[model samples]
Target: MAGVDPDDCCRGAHAAAQRGEFTQATVWDACRTGIRDAIESQLDDEQASPVIIDGLPTIGKTQHATDIAFGLDVPAAILTHRYETRDEHLNLAAEHQKTVAEIPTLDRDCPTRRGDHGSGWAERINDYRSRGASPTYLHYYLQDALPCMQDGDCPYLARWDAVEGADVVIGGPAHAALDRVVDDRVVIFDEDPGTAFRTEFDANQLSTAISTFLRRNDDLPVDNHFGLIGAATNESMDAIRDAIRDELSDNISIASPREAVDDDDGHAEAPTAVLAMLELGGPIIGDTAPAEYDWDDQLREEAGLDYVELPDGSQVVYDHAESRIIIRRPPDLTDSRAVVGLDGTPVEELWRGRLGVDDIESWRILCDDCRARYLRDVIGYTFVQTTSHVKPYSSGEYVNRRADFGLIEAVENRHETAPGVITTKSAAERLFEESPSEPFIDIQRVTNRIADVKHYGALRSSNDFTGTEVGIVLGSPHPGDRPLQITAALEGYTAVRDDEGKGTDLDYGIPDRPFLRHYREHKIAQAVLRFGRTTAATVYIHTGVLPEWLAEMVTAGPETVMIDERSEGQRGVIRALLDEAPGTAAEIAKRERVSIGEKQTRDWLKRLRSEGYVSRDDSQPYTWAADGLADAPHTARVRLPDLE
Candidate 1:
């Protein structure tokens, strides 16, 4: 779009028409003006306010973003995860495209399919040599600029000559970091975690005498006391933690911010000293970490201070995003230009808080029911398998070296089969080399039936299977992994347990032995929100183990293949209780329909009683009763002293 005009969208519509884009007669949906006005007001300000487009994922947020660029008659640089997202960038990027030769870079290797490798690779090599820099050398020497750099006109920063003229700039955080962005250019961060940056510290640096002692001794370590804090007591957690420690110790500072948070916070639900040493690059420097994240909470856990020593077997969780909010808003990447954030999660408060800008304009645009509709399109299983979190017990004596942990399978396998299964990385590892299960085989058949679409990767993670009929997540990765489930973490997806008896929000126990409990609840739901991105998702729970995490069909949306929880012979007992009269434990045991002896009857009755199907009398001779049961039996195992 060229030549701004008084009529808000006049020039934009014209340009889009000329370009044969944004042709929708009613391109702007219900919230168009709210967003349009926000952008315009920002532009009018001597200093533009960063806009946050907030709503559920897969709604028209992206469309609205594109419309804003068009409505304002400004060129846009769109940043997105997939190639298909290119269309979202304002028509400006298309105008900015340059042949490979046009991109100024120290890299002279003009890789081409049309080439003689010897001559092709060599010609570019010489071009790089002539520039007084090797292809490997960053021309502007921008490799070392901080997030708050003030260096001007570094060829390395603006080397993408195209970006200089580009109306808007789009790309990942790396693109956002480049000095190419100018005061006039508007920047948009499409996802959360926005554009903050962190550097890494060495994990080994965090090691101390206390941590080393805890490693070999039997004092029963405190939550965050040693380097092993948050690790499963078992060999699995210990092994992974040690390996991570090694990886951290070996770091030579590979360049650039990683896809996930590389520092402390990314290692698990929150930052630990080890992860802080390995991943958190700063000092967190001058920028305050997100307020939602409680730094002190983590500290208290590390010191085992401020915690009550509880009775044994109580659950204790150090602070995490769930119990309390830790604010992670980083300092502004730029002070001079406009920056906008687009998000699908319904968290205006969270995003605005993260932006930490007093004047950031946040609006909640209505989301469509497109997500629910997608749910109706698929059906699948949500397997609930249990794994052990065992660590060798260590007293003053020798340690038991045995560690048993069983979890799900690889990223690809969990994704490839099923109407879209949700599993953990650990679970995926279990199935990594195995063939699809019987149900999984059927899922594959269904997926394969779609000739033009595949339901493998993105479909399973979301309620909106926009491009395919189904979506499956290769199970959500454990928080301990480096990818940093940002969407999940942002939605307060941090796991919680009550076993530690502490007042903390996070479990400093072994990280992944849960391969189940911690993962299933938050992982699936978040996968649905971020869908392809792993924010939230869930499958029906079919287990005798944990039914609380199970959900009704259409977990993500309306579509579902819900299999009821397996009865496992509990139904017969339930049926027997339908209208039975109060009876002695022995009488109940002899009922022909019960089909079980006294021992079996006791177990079944206990199960039924706990679930509310049966009630036991507390009188003289206690008896069990349900709908058909008569008044309480005179047979209590012992009469409660008749209360006066």
Candidate 2:
């Protein structure tokens, strides 16, 4: 027996050993031996049994096959499903530094006439025969003739006969020629071990292919020379096994497949353990032990591990052992710990303080398998939705409403485009000139928010007064439900408008005034509140209505209560006092010398506070202040009467 590199052949065998499949270990060992023997044999005799190998994605199957082919000093031809154009083939050939011939399928070329002939009685009949060529027959013919074709004879002619004579054929799953090739050639199926057997071919085509290959070659000398290796996903091995049994009777193999190693005996080797670990989720900081960490106990406990427990009490589980890692929980200790490799090298660590409690809990539940698969697949593109009227302004309001509905976290309004009802480019120009800085908000600066708006329209002319209305619209990187809070904001705007137009002749104009301003203000407030809670970021409110006096009140100190738009100075002063210090109406009445008038003030303040502008903090004196104003910068400090 030839000496097999421990790193090259031990992974799958180790997994088999864990499953207690002793026979599988032998087979795995034999497969490696066969590869080495085949290489040496090829050196001694120009023709040797073709080496066949198979496995799931990332399970080292291709690596092993490549190594074997390289060892034998023979060229390898990889047939893939993605092979399309001659350019693609040429590119792959250049990449692998090997010649590639694609199997032609039913497409535009198969039924087309090669040469133009005058359509006539005789030529028509000849054309019909030429155009009626079968794809399968052409495929077969090409496979047999292409390799020997001279340079100018037709580039598509590189056929399967060439594959048969080649040193190695690294084939992907394609049924037509593979079934026939299995008879005289060494064949390998590079499948994703995690769910390779679950492929459509296994469910439908594998049985027929295997049976046909077996039946066709029955008469040939029973040479241990022909090898069959099925690469299984470490994650979905059970599925693969079931697929195999579904295809053939259980009695075909030497014995039921077994684990290639003994867990208690640490001598099993690292590559096997590494494969098992990769299947679970590649090594993780604080979750997986360094290779140097004595793994005797771990190996024993996870003898057939569906999950692995690290020293810190966090557990890493395997979902699709062949493809993903799912981190279930990190160690209990908050010490910044990470996953380390066998060489005690740190891979990655969970971000401390960056994640919320819910996110932390979620991270813990992730198993090794998902992590491995997802780490490389994380999305790189950042997407933002844009529409005509639905640009940044209305979109910001929609985002705020979404945040209220817990659909998003924050919304920052950047700019506003004039309502689409304005006619003429000149009118738009005028509106923009009046509010030049209010075009569209740059979406890049905002985080965790949705963008949505009311509607889009094109103006007829500058003087056209009929303001056409439209419904609300939304856009985002990913789709989500429309927020109900936005509807409430719209309703609030409508209520305020109806109240304002209580006795006006131009009440109809009320609908045309664009309810966006009301919506924008409310959304800004909401965004500020959410920002404070989620990211601990400051919220700056820049508005024309935000009085300089009120700015001073908030800026001087963290004042929770803000009262503005008051009609009478007395009422405003009394209300502001009571807001700064909440108490019974009777106590306020005594202080203000107003006979139960303080009750009315108290009632108004209570209503305003309930509307989300102000809130009461738990203090001995029971202080009240603006809720969303927590992070508002102190642009101006207003002197208020010391109510205490």
Candidate 3:
């Protein structure tokens, strides 16, 4: 057989890996080509000899660097500032040696004691020994340690020297030391500390550090050395650039923002293209494949659907709109008694009843039986009747029985028998007659239950004793029980409550009266501070669930209208614009609705615009421009002289 080309092998292995079939060896083989490409790109510009591989966290930056170094037959070293002490570097060297030898070794114990072992001097001595004042150290040690090795017994001194002389250094935080090394030596700073340092340090301190370091080091010839700096954080580069500009002035030349690699056409890779390619594939493989199941076919079958497989191997299917499995019905034995008419007629007679006199009761029983049969057959249970026209029970009475039965069991069995049996007046009358003075009567709760019936439509009656409709019918009122009512009250105990439920009505009570008063005053002050001077237009203040004080504040001024808090943050922007100029309430209302009436902008601009204050020229309508106002320069400050 003809020998398989390396590139061909690589491509095959890569494809297999993409399909999740490749072994580790095969993946490495395929990855070599990409690595070779990366290395070649790094080498192409000899003047910028060292290649900096940059990527976000877990984007395979370290692996990519490893591949490039090994594939290109170039030395790669990871530099890090985390190994700050001499001991740290010694430990790192030992770890690196052990790693290269594939030998299992316990991690070096980090010295914690202050007296002897943890002292800087002892660490320096150990550093010297590890860098090979000891005979057991490898020859690569001398080669790696020569450049930074001070002419002393320090272990890492040699290794540091070698690092300074080496073609590449890959590590984090160690980049700060790069300024001491000759510029021509290829110094690759794998990004870490420099990025973090920027956030905490002032710009001037950063500039001074860079200047001092650069001034001490002489530049190596361009052909002899190259500099590469890899950064994971974009902020790092920004900070570095600012520091460099401030420190080095015109001496340092920074490359413009460009993709780290070039494409087939020799143009630099577009930033987006590099990102897309780097993120080409989906999630990493853990020990096992994702917990996914091929439920499409099963789901389709269950839904009474047919699947059609396309030529492209994709499948299309139509599923059943409803369930196919029919429920088993209850036994129709004579002993199982069901109410027939409103007057307790037998179910058997109700089903075969007379024309006019028994029709309504008969139909009601038939409907109830049908619903019960459906529930028993489909849902696998006989529903217990909770309400009936013959023996009408108040919601409270039903609830008490439900409580006696334990809520869960009651919910499982309860059902409405007759639909549309409860009218709005009846519901209201029931509520009004049932201890109106009771603190927790919950009239609103009952009203909501009635509203739910209207919302779902006339397919089911409101007062039926069938579980399906009754469950829904009672849903709105059922939550008004003490437990649920208390929970709701606790949830909404936000220091303000109207005496009457109607928001428009002025009947109000402050449960925590003092706290409410203080809150209102604070809110008014905030509003005043937010809207400085430009008034005459509506300013939306978004304090959710308007406090009575805020309402009073708005009422105090014609220019300020306290609309519903629901219209706050979103509507504030439009309100700010309206405040700038006179606009009809209709226009304001329309604008508010369009913007969802959240007064975020109004909250932002309230301090600048007062309820009646206006700009010097009223010709232009006050439009809230977030960016415009933020960007405007403050040339003069107008203050009342006496107040100042």
Q: Which candidate is the best by lDDT?
A: 1
Q: TM-scores across all candidates?
A: 0.42, 0.23, 0.21
Q: What are the runs in model 2 whose C-alpha is more than 4 Å off?
A: 1-79, 84-100, 108-134, 138-165, 168-172, 176-180, 192-644
Ten contiguous residues with the weakest lDDT in model 3: 220-229
Give me the runs in candidate 1 sitting further than 4 Å from their true place: 1-28, 44-49, 73-77, 81-84, 87-137, 140-159, 193-196, 202-298, 302-337, 346-361, 367-429, 435-465, 471-644
CA lDDT, candidate 3, residue 548: 39
lDDT of 2 by residue, 528-601 (tens): 22221211122223222211222232221224223132224233423444345545444444554233465565
lDDT digits (tens) for residues 1-644 of candidate 3: 01123443234333454666543333333334433443454355432222222111112223444434333344443333333322233343442322211111111221211113346534443444322132212113443443222344334333455554444443443232234332332222223221211111122332232233333334411110011112112223444333432332232211111111111111111211112111110111112211222223322323233222212111222212321111111111121111111111112121211100122111111123322222233223211222211111224342221111122221222221212122122332443345443222233333333312221122111122222232222211211222221211222222223446431222224343323322232222222222111111112221222333233333223122111111233333333453344343233434532443324433434443442222223334444333333211111111211100
Q: Compute the lDDT for candidate 3.
A: 0.26
* C-alpha lDDT of candidate 1 relative to the true structure: 0.36
True-structure RMSD for candidate 3: 35.5
Candidate 3's TM-score: 0.21
lDDT of 2: 0.28
**Predictions in order: lDDT:** 0.36, 0.28, 0.26
Model 3 residue runs over 4 Å out of place are: 1-35, 46-64, 70-75, 80-158, 164-171, 176-644
Lowest summed lDDT over 10 consecutive residues: which window, candidate 2? 338-347
